[model samples]
Target: MRTAYSVETVRAAERALMARLPEGALMQRAAAGLAAACADLLGRVYGSRVVLLVGSGDNGGDALYAGARLARRGAGVTAVLLAPGRAHASGLDALRRAGGRVTGADDAEGPIARADLVMDGIVGIGGKGGLRPDAERLAGLADRSRAAVVAVDLPSGVEADTGEVRGAAVRADLTVTFGTYKPGLLVDPAREYAGIVRLVDIGLELPGEAELEALQHADVAQLLPSPAAESDKYRRGVVGIAAGSARYPGAAVLAVSGALRGGAGAVRYVGPAGDAVIARFPETLVSDAGPAGAGRVQAWVVGPGAGDDAATVAEVLAADVPVLLDADGLRLAERDAVRGRTAPTLMTPHAGEAAALLGVRREEVEGARLAAARELAAAYRATVLLKGSTTLVADDGGGAVRVNATGTPWLATAGSGDVLSGLAGSLLAAGLAARDAGSAAAHLHGLAGRFAADGAPAGAHDVAALIPEAWRDVYH
Candidate 1:
C-alpha cells in the first residue's frame, strides 16, 4: 500500500528526525536528492540552462544548494531570488562560490523563457492558498515557456493537506517531494497540477497509521475468498442482485455478469427483468419476487437502472445483510431508511449522485473529492465509494480512505458503475467488511477495465467478462 500522511504528522516526524541528526545534515541530504533528480531531467547537464525560482524559506535554500551542485558539474545555472534579503545567506554564498549567477526578477523572465529546465522552490509544504502576485506572475511565465518545470515538495499555491487549488498555482512537469507523501500529492485537484511525482527519502520515521491508502496486488490477494473441501455452493455464500426494469433488461444481465465472476458460490437475482438475466446466464437462479420473497443471500446488490422502484430499494435495505446501493438506489432510497439500517451499507455514487445527496453542485464534489467522500460517509453513516477519474472508498468509522490506483480512461462506458456495484456486493456476500469489500471491489474493477479496454473502446459486458482474468492476475 502507498500511504499518505497529513502535514501535521509530517512536521512532527521531521522535527524528531532533525533533532537526532547533526546540524545542516538533513538539508544537505534533501539537496543531494533534488540535484540528482534534476540532473536526470536535464539529460545533458553540461550544456543545459537551469533556472531556479528562489523564495524565502528552506525551500529556497534547497534550490540554492542544488543550483550550486549543478554549476560545479558545468551546467549554466541562474538563481532568480524572489526574496534577496531573506534568502539563505550560506546557500547564496555557496552558489556564488560555485559560479552560479544571481539575477533579479527584472532580468529573470528572459533567462526563464530560454532555459531548458525551471525549478520552482517558490513554496513548500508549509505554504498555503494560491501564489502571491509576484509568484503567480512567475508561474505564468513558467507555463508560457517551453522548459520542463520541476516543483519542490509540492506545486506552489495548492493546499498541502486538502488537495484544493485556490486562486493562482504553479503547474509542474514533475514534483520532488521530501520525507513522506503529502495528502495533496495523492488526491485530485492538487494531484492534477503535480504532473508526475517522485518522493525523496529524507529518513523521517512517520506515524504507523496513514490518512489515506492505495491497495496493491498483495493486499487484495489476502482478501479474496477461497472454498474449503467441505464447502458447498451455499456455504461459499450467495449474492442477491435486485436490479433493472422492464425498460432496461440489459442492466440486469450486466450486473449478473459481474456478480458471477466475483468468486461467490452463486447469484440469486430478483427483479422485473428476471427472464433477460436467466437467458444471458443460465446458471443464475432467477425470480420476479421482491427482496423479501427472495431466497437466502448473505448480501444484496440493489438499484442499477432500477427506475422508480423505491420499494425494492427499501426492502433490500431493511434486510439484516450487507447491501450495495448504486444508480437509482442512491436517488430513490430514503435517507432515514439508509441511516436506520443495522446492517452495513456501501454506496457507489458518481459525482452527480453524490452532489444530489450532499445538496451541492457536481463541480463542488469533483473539485474536493477527498472532502466530499468523507462528508458523505459521515452524513449517511455508511461506507461511500465515490467513483470518478480516481475512485475513493471512505467509511463512517473514520479510518484511512482507500484510493484506487488502476483503470483506463476508456472505462467511462454506459453501465460501468452497474458492473462495479455487483462486484462489490458479491465481495460483501463473501463476508468482507464494508471498507474491505469496497476497496477490493474497486481494485478488481479497475484492473478488469484495463484488460477489457486495452486500447479500443469497450462496453460494460467486455469489462464484466474480464473479471476472472483480473482475479487471476491478482493472486498469481
Candidate 2:
C-alpha cells in the first residue's frame, strides 16, 4: 500500500530525527538527495544552465546547497534570491565558494530565460496561499521557459494538507519530496501540478496510522476472495443485481458483465431488462421477481438504471442483505430506509449525485472531495464511494480513506459506474468489509478502464469485458 501522512505528522517526525543529529546534518542529507535527483534529470551536470528560485526558508537552503553541488561539477548555476537579505548565510557562502553567483530578483530574468532547468524553492509545505509577486513573476517565467521545472518538497502554492491549489502554483515536471509522501502529493488538484514524485528517505521515523492509503498489487492480491474445494455456489456468495430498466436495457448487460467477473459464484439479476441481461450473460439467473421476492442473495446492487422505480429501490433497501446503491437508485431510494438498515450499506455517487445529497453544488463536492466524501459517509451512516478522477472510499467508522491509484481519464464514459457498483456489491457478498469492497472494486475497475481504452475511446461494455484481465493482473 502507498501510504500518506499529514503535514503535522511529517513535522513531528522531522523534529524527532533532527534532535538526534547535528545542526546541519538533516539539511545536508536532503540536499544530497535533491542534487542527485537533479543530476539524473539534467543527465549531464557539466555546463548545464541551472537556475534556483531561492526563497527565505529551509526550502531555499536546500536549493542553494544543491546548486553549489552542481556548480562544483561545472554547471552554470545562478540563485535568484527572492529574499536576499534573509537568505541562508551558510548556504550562500557554500554556493559562492563553489563558484555559484547570487542574483537579485530583478536580475533573475537573464539566467531564468536560457536555463536548462528551474528549481523551485520559493515555498514549501509550511507556506500557504498564492505566491508573492516576485515568486509569482518567476513562476510565470518558469511556465514559459523551455527548462524542465522541478519542485523541492511539493509544488509551491498548493495546500500540503488538503491538496487544494489556490491561485497561481508552479506546475513541476518532477517533485523530490523528503521523508514521506504528503497528502497533497497523492490527492488531486495539487496532484496534477506534481507531474512525477520521487521520495528521498531522510531517516525520519513516523509512527501511528496514515491518513490515506492507495492499495498496490500485493496489497490487493491478499484481499481477493477465493473459494475452497468444499464451497458450493451459495457458500461462495450470490450477488443479486437490481439494475437496468426498459428504457436502458444496456445497464443490465453491463452490470451483470461486471458481477459475473467479480468473484461471486452466481449473479441473480432482478430487473425489468431480464431478456437483455440473459442475452448478454447467460450465467445470470434472470428474474422479474422484485428484490424482496428474489431468492437468497448475500448482497444486492440496486439503482443502476432504475429510472422512476422508487418502490423497487425501497424494497431492496429494506432487505437484510448488504446493499449497494448507484445512479438513479441513489436519487430514488429513501434515505431513512438506507440509514436504518441492519446490514451494511454502500452508496456510490459521482460529484453531481454527491452534491444533491449534501445540498451543495457539484463544484463544491469536486473542489473538496475528501471533505465531501467524509461528510457523505457521516451523514448517510454508511460507507460512501465518491467516484471521479481519484476514487475514494470513505467509511462511516472514520478511518484512513482508501484512495484508488489505478484510474485513467479515459474511464469517464457513460454506464461505467454501473459496472463498478455491481462489482463492489459482489465483493460485499463475498464477505469483504464495506471499505475493502469499495476500494478493491475501484482498483480493478480503474485498471480495466485503462485496458479497455488503450489509447482511443471505449464504451462501458469494453471496460466490463476487461475486468478479468484486471483481476488476473492484480493477483499475478
Question: Pick by TM-score: which candidate is best?
Answer: 2
Each prediction's whole-model lDDT (CA)? 0.90, 0.90
Please provide, for model 1 over 206-266, each residue's C-alpha lDDT reduced to its tens digit, 9 standing for 90 to 100. 9768988888999999998988999888888899999999998888888888899887899
Instruction: Write down the lDDT that model 2 would get.
Output: 0.90
Model 1 CA deviation exceeding 4 Å by range? none
| TM-score of each model, in listed order | 0.96, 0.97
Give Cα distance to truth, residue 376, candidate 2, Å: 1.2
Q: For residues 1-476, what per-residue lDDT tens digits would candidate 2 score against the true structure? A: 88888889999999999999999899999999999999999999998999999999999999999999999999999999999999988998999999999899998888889999999999988878868888899999998989999999999888787777767889999999999888788777788889899999999888998888889989888888999999988998999999889999888788888888898889999889999988878888988878777799999999998899998889899888899999999999777887788899999999999999999999888877888899999988999999998898999988888898697898899889989988898999998888999999999999999999998899988998999999999978
Model 2: runs farther than 4 Å from truth?
A: none
